[model samples]
Target: MSSTELPESVAAAVDPRVSPVRVAEGETLRSVVLPGLTLAVRSRSATAEGAPPALYVHGLGGSSQNWSALMPLLADRVDGEAVDLPGFGDSPPPDDGDYSVTGHARAVIRLLDAGGRGPVHLFGNSLGGSVATCVAAARPDLVRTLTLVSPALPEIRVQRTAWPTALMAVPGMTGLLGRLSRDWTAEQRTRGILALCYGDPSLVSEEELGHAVREMERRLQLPYFWDAMTRSTRGIVNAYTLGGQHGLWRRAERVLAPTLLVYGGRDQLVAYRMARKASAAFRDSRLLTLPDAGHVAMMEYPREVARACRELIDDYDRS
Candidate 1:
C-alpha cells in the first residue's frame, strides 16, 4: 500500500519509505526475498555522521514501527534501521513454516547481506532478542556490538508468573483463545495484548492502542496470522529450550560483540531474575536495570531507554 494509504498507526510507527535516515537521499525502499516471503526495507542517511549503524529487530507480533520514535533520536548518535521480523510486521512468513529462532536469524542474515550493511550494532527484544543472539553467534562478523532489551534466553528454569509465555505454551490454548474470543473483534484482541505486555497497562493510549487494534484486525484477516503466531510461539519455545551449543545462552557466550543487556525490574515476560544470568552469558556484557519499566521499556520509558542506549554506544565506541 502507498504510504498515505497505510493506517495511521502504521504511519505513526515508521516514516514513509522515502524518508531516509542514515543513508543518502538516493537510497530507496528495497525488498529482500527469503524463502517464504520478502522483507520490506527502508534506510535513513547517516545522521550519526560516520558512526556505525544499528540494526533493530522487533519482538513477536510487532513491526518496524516499534522503533519509530527512538530511531530519529538515535540516528544522530548512531546510524540505525529497524526491521519487521517475518510474519509479524510487513515481512513475510518462513518457507518451512519454521518460526524457530534459527529460522528467524537466517532471515535476518539474509536481510543484512541483501540490505548491504556489515558488522552492525544489533538490538532486539523478547523473541527478536533470541533471534538476534543467534545471528550474532552464528556470524559474529556481521555484528559489531549487541544491545538486547529483555531478550528471551533459555531459562535456567521457567520464571514464575510469566503468564503470557505460559499461556502460549499450553496445548490448544491458541485455538481456545481464538474460540473464546473469536467474536470479540480484533480491537479487543489488540487491547488485551497491550495490557499483557505492559505492567502499568497505560503506556498505550486508548487512541494509540485503538490504531494497533485495527492493525491487528486487518492482519488477522490475512491467512497466515494465526498460523504464524502459533509457529512463532513454537519456534521460541523450541529455541529457548535448546541445550549445549544450540541454546541461547551458549550463543550469548560466543558473541564477541560488547553487549548491553537491558531488563525491566518489573518486566513480567522475561523476568528480572533471569537478567543476572543473561549478563553473565556475554563475556563483554554489562547489565542496565530499569527499576520501573515493564516488558517494552523503550516504548514505555523512551527517554531513559535512549539514554541507556547512548551510554552503551559510548562504551562501545570508546573501548
Candidate 2:
C-alpha cells in the first residue's frame, strides 16, 4: 500500500465531502451500517497492509470530529478509525430510539464484529470512555488495548459544575433548558462549551473557535441534535446508577486488556479524582494526568496524547 493512498475498495467507500473541514492529513470519512445502527466512521486514508487496527469512540454531543486531531497523529502506528455513534454527527438515530450505554456499546461491538476489526486498540473519551469500558469487559476479545480520556465513571459526589449537564437526562429537563436558553446563538453556545471543556480558553485560536461555532451552527440545524444529547445524557445517568457486575466500576475490573487512562486536572465534568480509581480498577493500567488540560485533552494536547499512545503501543510490541 502506498503511504498517501488508500486501497481502491476503501477509497471507494469514503465520502470525501462528509466532513471536509474536519478531515485531517490522511483520513477519510465513510458510513458503516451495522445490524441495528448506521455510523459515520472516519479512518486513516492509508496504512500498512498488516498494521493493527484501532477504533475511536466520541463522547455525548461530540462526533467523529472529536478525533480529528488524534487520529492523524497515530496514523503511522495503526489503521485508525473513529465512529460517530448513533444519533450523533452524520449518523441517524437508531430505529428503536435506544441511546443507553449498553445500546451504544452494542453499536460499537457490532461494527467491530461485522468489519472483522476485533482485537483492536480501542480509544474512547468522556461518555465514550464509559461505553468502551463496557465493551472491553463484555467482549474482551474485540479489544486489544483500552485507552480512556476522562471517562464518566460513576462518582459519589458529582462535580457542582457538571450538575446541569447531568440534569439534562431527566424526563423534562431538556425541554426546560431549551426553553430557557432558546435565544442563545450558536456562537454563544459554543463559547459556553469551550469554557467548560478547555482549561484555558485563550489557548484556542480564533480560527479554531470560529470553526467550532460553524460546526455548532450546522449541528443546531439537525432535528435530532438535542434529542441525541438528552438521551445520551440520560444514558450516562442511568449507567451511573447501575449496580452489581453491570456497574462501570465492576466493568473496569473485568477489563483484561492493558489500559491507559488519561485525565485532565481542570475537567469540570468528570472529576480528576476518578483517575486514581480507574487506574486501580484496571489491573494492568497506567494513568496520564494533564494538569493544564480540561475535558478534551486529546484536542488541546494532541501531540502529548499521541506520544503517550505511541509509548503504550511500543510497550505492547516489546511485551
Candidate 3:
C-alpha cells in the first residue's frame, strides 16, 4: 500500500541469524533481515554473471523450496531467488503479526528495494500469486514481467474441495483443526497434501515425498505455524471480499508488466474457468493451460512452465 522503497535505516539493519535448511546441489540459502521482518532466501547459481534478477514467492504452507524444481531451469536466463515469507520456511513471524496479502506484498517489496533489484521477473503460486498481483499493481516500476501459477483470486462460485481451506479463516477453526489432527503423523499430513495439491500424486518420487514429510515434521514443531496458516488464509478471504480500488481483480487490471497466467485443468483449488477472466484483466497477458497438472504447476511440470516463462521473457525482450 505504501512506497516500495525501504528506509535507509531499515535496509542497513541486517540480522545475522541464519537457520539450516535443505539446499539442492546448485542452490544456496541465506537470511535477510529488515526492520520488523526476516526472510529466508533460496537462490540458484545463474548460468551467466549478468543475467536479469528474478524473484519467486511460494503459496501458503509452502517454503522457498517450492521453486527448487523450476529455478534451476531458468538459471541461464535469470538470477533467481525464492523467498520464504514470514512464519513460513525458515523465516520467522513478522513483529506486527500481520499476515494479510498487503503485508506479504510489503515484505516482498521491502526485500526487493533493499537488494536494489527492481524490475525483476516476479513469479508466484496460489496465495503468492495474489501477493505478486498486489506488488505488481502497487509498484509497477519494480516488476518487469509477472507470472502466476494457479493464483487464488476471488471466485463467484467456490469449489467444494477448496472450501475447507477457506474455512480456516473462520475464528477458532485453526485451533479446532489442530486439535483434531493432533494424532496425525507427518507422513500422513504430507500424503494428504500431495493428494490434494497434485493432479497425479503417484508422479511424485519417493525422495520428494520424504523431503516433504520431513519439512512437514519441522513445521509442525514450530509454535507459530498454525497461526501463520490461519492468518494468511484469512488474508486471502479478506482480499476476495474487498471491492473498488483495493480489489485483487482491480489490481490485476492495473498491472503494467507483461503477464503469464498458468492454470491447471485438474486444479482442485483455483478454478480453471478464471483463466479467461485473468487473461482479460492483465492487458498484456498470455495464458498456459496444463490439463494434467494441479495447483503447483511449477513443481509438477517444471520444464513446460520454464519454457512458457522463457517465451514470456523472450517476447517481452523483442517488443
Top candidate (TM-score)? 3
Worst 10 residues of 3 by lDDT: 5-14
Model 2 stretches with alpha carbons more than 4 Å out: 1-22, 46-49
Per-residue lDDT of model 1, residues 1-319, tens digit only: 1121222224222223321222223223444565465665554445646878788888887776666656666777777777767776655566667677888898889878765677898889888899899999999989988889889887755666665555665678888877877788777777677766776777677766765765675566656677778778878887767788887788889999888888987777788888888877899887888887777877777777788788878887787
**lDDT of each prediction vs. the true structure?**
0.73, 0.86, 0.90
Ranking by lDDT: 3, 2, 1
| TM-score, cand. 2 vs. native | 0.92
Q: How many collisions per candidate?
A: 9, 1, 1
Each candidate structure's TM-score, on Cα atoms with residue i matched to residue i, is 0.86, 0.92, 0.94
Model 3 Cα shift for residue 126 (angstroms): 0.4
Candidate 2 per-residue lDDT over residues 1-319, each given as its tens digit: 0012223233222243233335555667677765557777888743557779999999989888898889888878888889889888767788888999999999998888888888899999999999999999999999888999999899999999999999998899999999999999988999999999988888999988988987787677767789999999999999999999989999999999999999999999999998888899999999899999999999999999999999888888788
Against the true structure, what is every candidate's RMSD?
5.3, 4.3, 5.0
